[model samples]
Target chain A: MNQIDIGKWSQRDLNMLRTSSDTREIDLLTTSVRDLNATLQAFGSNTRSDEASFRVLTPNGAHAIAVGIDAPLNVEIAGHVGYYCGGMNKCASIIIDGNAGQGVGENMMSGVIHVKGDASQCAGATAHGGLLLIEGNASARCGISMKGIDIVVKGGIGHLSGFMGQTGRLVAFGDAGEALGDSIYEARIYVRGKVESLGADCIEKELRDEHRAELFALLKQADEAHKADVSEFRRYGSARKLYNFHIDNAGAY
Target chain B: MCGIAGLFIKRTRLQPRLGELLASMTSTLCSRGPDSAGFALYTAGEPGRAKLTLTSVEERADFEALGEMLSRAVSAPVSVVGRYTHAVVTVPADLVNLCRNWLLENAQDVRILSEGGHLEIYKEVGYPDDIARSFGIASLGGTHGIAHTRMATESAVTATGAHPFSTGPDQCLVHNGSLSNHASVRRELGRDGIVPQTENDTEVAAGYLTRELKRGRSLGEALKSSVEDLDGFFTFVVGTKNGFGVLRDPIACKPAVMAETDDYVAFASEYRSLTPLPGIKSAKLFEPKPATPYFWEH
Candidate 1:
């Protein structure tokens, strides 16, 4: 119902607008996190940050637009987001024009969240539904307790990603964090990257033909530089012991 | 509409704020259904039957009048067992058969959402917290219960659309899936004197399953009948007087998980939902194979 332009507004005025879905149609290029936060607040459920249609725009000097909406909003944040960007979405579709921050797309359900940017730590720590795409790098705790969501980080993730997942899929582009899928329950993790270290109960498994096909489909759709070849990556999953509670695997840490 | 959560406190006395846990699950899922909420809990030898929610009457007085008529029509004594936006009736065990008959006849106007021994429900157009406060579902202390979190993509977000719908006496079902053959199935079931309360395929499945179970078929057989007979991608969890049950269409398009241990058991469309159940950290969780029906008999 309102349009508060960040480009013209003073810095003090920017913080007042916490979230958005208005006038997201107008492209005001600035890289300040305060302005971008205003942009996140202005754009509500119907629009996107930088949705499906791609364009090259580098907004310099931005930190974060954390706590995005819970609707079908999309975004292509040029360059990278600092931290916790695109968090808590419902039916939005966002693709980072560049790399992303740590904990990207946290607690999102029912949308497609992509990060062409290298993600920081704990990417997708506790998401519900939707597909998360990380093109370059991803930090630790990716897809932890991820319920019905799928994450494909093209690069590598930090330690302790996916510590306690319920139901969903986590696909890594390169390598994964340590203690991945520890105490996991019902969620599936697929990685095309190397296994620097396995989580508590995580183990490398065969990348079946079905997995190859799925990776191919995602790569073809996601705008990553390595869209063509996914043969180098391997798959990791639970040993099925974590499916049930065990005294031997007592330490979920 | 709103959220619903039921837990049967078996091993020991229920937590003092057991209702709070259910309220949390329902309220957390408030975005799914934001209209109304209700809950019921029955203890041993209460001799009280629960009427799960089915529909929102155009007029409350008219719905009450219908309740009276249904009691006489089915030769049972019916009462507004649980008050909410929808219908939740409680009858004596002797009158359950008559109540079922009444529910069948009145299915056109209302749905017998869920009627059983342990739990009762009806919800719409709100979050779970509002419903729990109004219906006092948080207070029900039973051995087990089932709740619904709805998005209403396929079904209208109405009281009739509230979940834990009835399929048979002492049987209520919660589902998360789309039924492609809803119209055809409705037509087929209509020929057999079963009237569904809504256009939602979930209610139709409930009606069909109710008919099958009342006709002396076991729940497993009735559920197995659904694999091929029920079309489309779906996964459902049905709760009855005897135990907990899980079912899916020929393909398990919807997500579901079951966790069991010597002390307790839990299942949800997503694994995170199970976190609130008692003894969760100590539980063992497993996913059901596609189209396979899993049952935990008490």
Candidate 2:
């Protein structure tokens, strides 16, 4: 573990680091959240920055660690983080070395957030656009109400994942808990393992060549291209029965 | 936004450090819950004695006199020790309910926290850090323990509303997330004569478990029944005299993580709370699945 004295680095220093093409390290235990957030805000405000990298140590379950960052820098958090670790992220490539609490990449417009360990509930909740990848299992509501994001989970996901999704793709390599993809719309789901139960309006469909290609590409991006066969996945999507007004389905509704 | 933590020592060597480890784990979740904090410690008890924990609205109360009165009424010795706004009363094991009934009829200002041969509960409405320090929990020793920090979603912030709710002898429960069907369940349990002291949904859950256990169901079986009957989002960690358990609701929206090593089995609302545990770096870590109940006995 690299020990860093947070007092040695200032927010101004962080801005300069963003402009410079070098890697930096910051210890969360040694610094206050105000300073760390100030540094992240400064890094976000400046556009057209160099390819800088930051290594954060001892996150220790703090919430909103790298929220609302618009930069394309590489950020790595060394320990477990609390809620909203990469919330509202844009263009940044954030990585968590350990497990993440709730809403790891919630509402991200554009970016890549990778968790090397397990993620809590609502990992990518309500995200519009981004690529969220989890190497380990994710708890409930993994991609609820997703608009345009593409999520890839290598392990099992808990209940209520991909609920009310408007548009996007969710690919899971392991089992799904109860009520997966409830009341979904447009978004497609691909699961390689057992699905405990399907949600309302969600039905399994045949895997076509186009879906296989897409899954393969997603796996390559998530760095798991050679791990499994893409043809093993089953597809799930909305049945479109709930989209129109029908008096026959009134009692069901 | 509540925090729940539990520690069960599997190795005999780590038994003495249970309180120190649990205090650190519970204190890590201070930011998650700032309204109240409480813990239930399972210490060594005398063969024929039970401990009754009580909390008053204020720090000043006639706990000594209450103990004397209880001793006289039960025809047994009763000893009292005051800690902050709470007190522990030790009496004969079989007369626990007698003393508890006496308190309920006489001492209206004091609330019974727990009554068991091996369990002692302490709780207060304050910052979690302050409550832990005031109780001097770190220096205490035990075989196992559980704690909670409450954000108070359903009820007001009171010591009675704090978690580690003990509904049965040597049994306690702490919870995260709200129960959507708690109002109906509370009514149902009340009809069964398992009334709860506070309006907190967690207390209702505890009452349900106590009722199930009273009906000759095992801890694991009661938890499994909870998965079928309980509605809403919740991650519950229950502690008994000789066992520990964890259960998540079907939806499982709430967060829960468990870590186990040769030395101990630990649980927390988040993984950060498990960092201070011994050998956690190499411990077997996993998130409990939804609707799956897990139990550990010693």
Candidate 3:
């Protein structure tokens, strides 16, 4: 892996990583580090090059994709990660600055992860824990999961999403797509946006003042735009039937 | 690490409930610096004299002793201003420095937050309301005043690290921003014989601006001088016995919002932080022109 060309990494970091190639990974991520995978291939790590790693790039221009290095690593893609990147952030943090790709923070998780950017889906399709932060908009099927992974989309999530979520939290700052949490298991879906419709036993509950306060508090910390009066949004979650796999709730999504 | 809020009553009609108004503002800023909070307020009766409120005094060993020491130096009757772990002392028109020195030297780490006309200084380690109530600022009354709350970042979240620092007579300043060029400015101020008593960047700002204001410069001119002298981003909400001024640095690294109604005006880090009103009007937001000196007339 050390012999492979890491040139395919983002242009933002090409200059930085080009300057130093042998620093320890632990030191690189002390504050805000860039996740430039291709650059890692050139450095000779005492550990295997195939392992997960995260580094923050200076972000001079907009030209980097597939920012995640590999699995068993969580990369918090800090700034703006450009395009189809983070498609395979299995077991790592792939948080972005603002928005992210068609498939972000996708797949496996013995380790948890995050994506600060708005994902483009299919995000978190398989197992996971840790969390993801989409400070903006998510395009589609944010969490087509089958296992335990907490996917928090602080923005609006797209259609057919959480289609078969087995479990965990699916937080959305905005609306959920049609047939959300469909045939979904114990997964908890909290949305500040209006749902087009419910999938299966998924039901909408009134967002009380306390709930509004809670959501507002979260949005405030994330620096997301939220009206002081958060009564504008609704809440969605499991109807409990999904926990037992009732015949009526089967494929209800 | 401290959060300070002030209420400057424009119309004398709003004068009677000045203390209550200041208490509300201090309480609103509780989250910013929960450690301790205080209010330094002044009414028209006691003109030119600063009445400081030292709130939530967990330690009593130096409280009265410090107050007595300040009174002898200020040459004015520095009475025990309030209660609730807080004390209030008065600085005569010419003895502000002597009073400040006594407060600094006599106490372990004293924060002189807002020593304008009848300075009402209050502080605690966590929770602004607790400090305000403890100091009894909720009942103290005046037209112009300042307060502080803090989230410890650069300096220890102690009474000394609070805002509304005294720069001159009936003149004080509150700051929000990190001074990137603190070392350079400190050296410059030191060269001019102005000594800062704390490690906080704001103290350096207060010290530098205070020196300029003492040299017969107007508040506006002094702030302008600070703009030329200080480096890095900042938005300052300065208070005086007469009124308050809002100034910002060129970069505007931090967020500050100001809104004015026919009756009252408000300034805060976030737009929503201000008390929401009935109208759909938008706030007039301005980031200080980097390195430009700006201030408002009372």
Per-residue lDDT for B136 in model 1?
Answer: 68
Where is the poorest 10-residue window by lDDT in model 1 chain B? Answer: B1-10
- Measured by TM-score, the strongest candidate is 2
Alpha-carbon lDDT, every model: 0.60, 0.85, 0.56
DockQ, all candidates in order: 0.03, 0.50, 0.02
TM-score of 2: 0.90
| Pairs in steric clash, model 2 | none
> What is candidate 1's lDDT per residue for B1-298, written digit by digit as tens?
2223334444545534445556655555555455433443333435555454445455343557767777778666677643655555666766776666766666555655555665555455566666667666666555666667666667677666667676555677777777888889899888988877677788888887877887788888888888878887777777677667778664344545556766556665443455566666556645455566777766
- TM-score, each model? 0.51, 0.90, 0.48
Docking category for candidate 3?
incorrect
lDDT of 3 by residue, A163-210 (tens): 777665566767776777766665556776788678776666667665
Candidate 2 local lDDT, A179-222, one digit each (tens): 88988888888999999899888899889887788788778777
> Which 10 consecutive positions of candidate 2 chain A have the poorest summed lDDT?
A6-15
Candidate 1 residue-wise lDDT, A1-253, digit = tens: 1111212311111122123434243232534445654555555555543342322244321334535654344445554444566777655556566555456778876566667555655677788666677766665567767766677776676566677777766777666645667767667677666565676767777887876776665555455436457677676667777667778767753
Local lDDT at A242 for model 1: 63
